[model samples]
Every structure is written in structure tokens, then in C-alpha cells.
Target: MRASASWAIRAVIAVTTVSVVAACGSGNDDGTSASPADGQKLSVVATTPEVADFVRNVGGDGVQVTQLIKPNVDPHEYEPTPADIQAIGTASVVVKNGVGMEKWLDQTIDAAGFDGTVVDTSQGVTLRKGDPDDEEMAEGDPHIWHNPLNAKIMAENIEKAFVAADSGRADTYRKNYRDYAAKLDALDAENTKKFDALPADQRKLVTNHDAFGYYIDRYRLEFVGSVIPSMDTSAELSASQLTDLVAKIKATGTKAIFSESSLPPKSAEAIAQQAGVKVVGGEDALYGDSLGTEGTPQGTYIGAEEHNTDTIVKALGG
Candidate 1:
């Protein structure tokens, strides 16, 4: 009877140990814990590189950011992979550059079965209406971050979301947002002074796509036209459109055709050649759709905007 009781006790201990192990392993299928461990950084998934940068700045060391879209990749044409969906599934919050930028976002979220808080950074910022003719951008231009003031709104939205998701770190997030906002203000002021110094005619811009509307509007520069003719890079240019753009470039006396880092420069180069204008390709391409490589100066939002300003100013004879 003593041996039998001892055996029963051992069996109970084994069952309890197994139960504990199973409970610990029964997290999301993506290998993430069902909930963040105490003191663990909040898991965040940002739909785009720029959005990821904003989250990083606002969340600071309090969040682990997973950027769905890679750097230098066009967000307009990006298709989320299984890994991206899994990341979203396990994330505590998802941040996006709303205004129809991520057309695939809703479906991707559904597929991920995510029930996390979503932060749309474009909220409260004034939106620019797109060309009514283009179906993709007929709603509105989604690239609001090009304007520094608009970016401030985005950062504010991010900070709020971060605080809501992790209220324990609210102070840290707010402080980071304020610090980043100051940097953005300084960047805007410096760029404004430099751009205002240039003649209005010399501020004309021709780019690979209609991605710089906010930038142009913010700095009061004239946009001659774009190679793609639409805000979305996935849009194709027809023969007639190409010919008309070349004509417009010549008529506007646009000095340079600026290609985007995320797009193919062949089209811009061809148009520039036809229009007899210099094409800023290769390293000098603008970071319109995406940021530069991680760990580089242009990888950050401020760095990319500065590069764009310097490139445009130099190319446009500023």
C-alpha cells in the first residue's frame, strides 16, 4: 500500500510538470508568447519602413518593431508574406500610413487573425486629393509624411497609440515623441530657408512618380510632372502619356528628372533623354516610396528627407 501511494504521488507530479510545460508552450502558432512577459518590450508591426521609423522613435526602447515592408521596396505594390502575417498575428499593435497606402492591409490583417490595436498615422493630417482620372489615387494622395508638419501629426498619433498599448511606458513614449518632433521642426525650418533662397522658377521638380505632392506643396515648389503620372508606382505609363510628359518637361524648362530609389530609373532616364534634361539616377535618386538601407544615414526619415532636399536643391540649381 505504501509503494502504491508513492507511485500515485510520482504520477501526479509528472502530470503536473507536463501540464506546466504544455501551458508555457501553448502560445501563438507563430512562436510568440500569448502575452508579453512582464518587463518585455511591446511587440509592434509597422506596415512600411517610414512607419517603422516613426514607431521606433516614439516607442523608443519600449517596443520591438517588425517592419513588414523592407527598405527601398515600393509599398504600393508590396505583397505581404506568411512571415509578415505571422508577425502581425503576434504583435500588440500595428501602425500604418493610412490614406489608402496599404491596400493589402485589411486583408492581410484578416488573414493574420489579428485583434490588436491599429494606429493610422495619417489621422488628423490634411489630405491632398489625387488626380480624379487615376483610379488608384482618386481617393487621395497617401504620402502625407513628405511634409514635416504632417509628419508631426503622424508622430503624435504614434505616441498616443504606443501609450494606449503600453501605458506603463507612457512617459517614455511622450518624451521620445517630443524630442523627435523638435528634430523634424528643425529639419523643416532649415529646408524652408534653403528652398526659399532659391528662385521660384528654379524650384520646379520632375520626379519618377507623383509621390512628392506634399513635399512640393510644403515648400511651395512647382511640380512639372512625373514619369509614372500617378501617386502609385504600380501604374504604367502609355506612349501618349510619355510623349506628353516629355513635352511638358521641355515647356516647363525643368532642369532634372529625379528618379526614386524604390522605382526603376529606366523610364525616368528615357524621358529625360527625350526631353534633353539631366536625370538624377543611381545614388542621387530620391527616397520617395521608401527609406534607405538600415544603419545608413538615409535609412531614417529625417536623413532621407535631407538627402531629397539636398539632391533636389542641387539638381534644380538652388
Candidate 2:
């Protein structure tokens, strides 16, 4: 009986020693347990759908990106959710389309306690002056990505940030940026050729809001006016302002009123009816503030720009 009890005690000690060894092997040298996501990839957070797309193109397999604002959501009035804050808190980098575009971002970052690298994609691009009357856009227009040239600059900025964060993947990020930048250049050239082929009068645009200033300036197109006078969608249109826009549309002989995917088309439709022009809505609406759903043609930055060009060209008799 004594011999049997001693064997039993030895067996218990052996099992406990093995369990402790296994647990120690599972942890790091510092004694903290390993997480599933540890050393997987660099975690990134993008503010908008467009910025997210840019980051994906640049980062490729090197990053796991969390897009804060989903497609078809208005960024001008977007409020961050708890999930967004959490993601920001854990991200190693946050890429934003700066220039007063993300009004809620500063406070959101503060709330998240994020001390990560923040990449403002609009750092080097020349900004278009916003409507002085509107406080939201008093500094400058934040729609710089509409022009593919500006997008190239933004992509370069993103690539630099990625390299700074993860120097080991610098070559991968640079190669990806070059490939995407070439594609952007090709798109820009193609659109410029297409628009240049049309008469100057056919290049006039009347959009839902002042979200395409860079695009208009890039293509040398005349901006008739926006249904919403202010760059912000939250601004209400006064009765006189609406009447004046209708008159301007009629006076300029605008071909069609292009509604935005992120905004309500009712105002554009009303204005178009008053001005005796068709309103481009539904699937044909321009992606002013966001892209289409993922996996669709219009879901990507290039695809959305191509769609916008085609829609505008067809509507304007080009």
C-alpha cells in the first residue's frame, strides 16, 4: 500500500511539471501570453471608403485595414461609433483625407487615446478654396481625391507612412505604390483625352454639392452650381437660393443634374425639374463622397472615377 501511494504522488508531480512547461513555451520571454494577432500584420485604420481603398492598394498583404466610414455614408456629418474608436485605439496607423474633411476625427482620436502615426493624404496637393460664406468649408475643399493626380500624391504619402511604420516591408509598399500610381496616371490621361475631345460648352457640370471642385478643375469643366449651396450636405437650401440656382442652371444651359450616391437625390431632381433637365440618380449617380459597394465595379476608386466620367460624358452629349 505504501509503494502504490508513492507512485500515485510521483504521477501527479510529473503531469503538473509537463503542464507548466507547455504553458511557459506558449508565452514570450517577458512572460506575457501570445495573442492570435500578434506578429500577423500591421493593423491600419482608414477614415473613409476612398482612403481605405488607397491604403489597401498600397499596403496589399502587409496590412489589415479597418475602414471607419462605410461606402455611401456622408463623411461631412459622420459621427464615430464605439467600434471605430476601439479600432483606432488598437491601430498602428490611421490614414485620413485631411483638409477639413473629417470634422469628427480630432475628437475621435482623442477619445480613442491613439498615439499612432496619422497620415494626412492631402498634405502636398494644392487645395481649392471653399465657399467663404460656409464655415464648414471656410478653410478649403476636402475633395482632393477626385483628381487622379492628387490621388497619386495621396498614395505616395500613404506609401511613405507605411515604410516609416514597417521598414521591413518598404520594398513591397513602394512596388505597390508604383503599380497603382501608373494605373492612376493612365486613368487621368484617358479621362483628359475623353473630355478634351468634347466641346467646351458640353463640359459644364451641376452637381448635388460642391464635392467635385478638384475634378472640375482637373478636367477644365465649368461648374454651373450645386443643388446644396454649401459643401456640407447638412446645410439647408433657402427658397431664394434654390430659385437662383434654377435660374443659373437655365442660364448656363446645363445638360443634367448629377446627384451623389451619399446624398438624397430629391433636391437634385427638384432642381432638374425646375431647370428643365434630367436628374442622374440611382446607379448612375456620381460617387461624390464615397464609392459603391465592395466587389462592384464602382466600388473601387478607379472604377468610381470611370463611372463618373462615363455618366457625365453621356449626360452632356459628349
lDDT of each: 0.84, 0.84
Query: For model 1, where is the 10-residue window of minimal lDDT?
Result: 18-27
Per-residue lDDT tens digits of candidate 1, residues 1-318? Answer: 124533543444443433333323313576433445679998989998899999999988899999999998988877666566667766878899998888777766665656667889999999999767666577689999999999999999999887766778889999999999999999999899889888998888999889999999999999988888788776688999999999998898889999999998998888888999999989989999899999999999999999999999988983
lDDT of 1 at 61: 88
- For model 1, the stretches where C-alpha displacement exceeds 4 angstroms are 1-37
Off by more than 4 A, model 2: 1-39
- TM-score for candidate 2: 0.87
Give the per-residue lDDT of model 2 (tens digit) for 207-273: 9898999999999999988988777777778999999999988898888999999999998888888
| Best candidate (score: TM-score) | 1
Instruction: Find the 10 residues in a row with the least total lDDT in model 2.
Output: 19-28
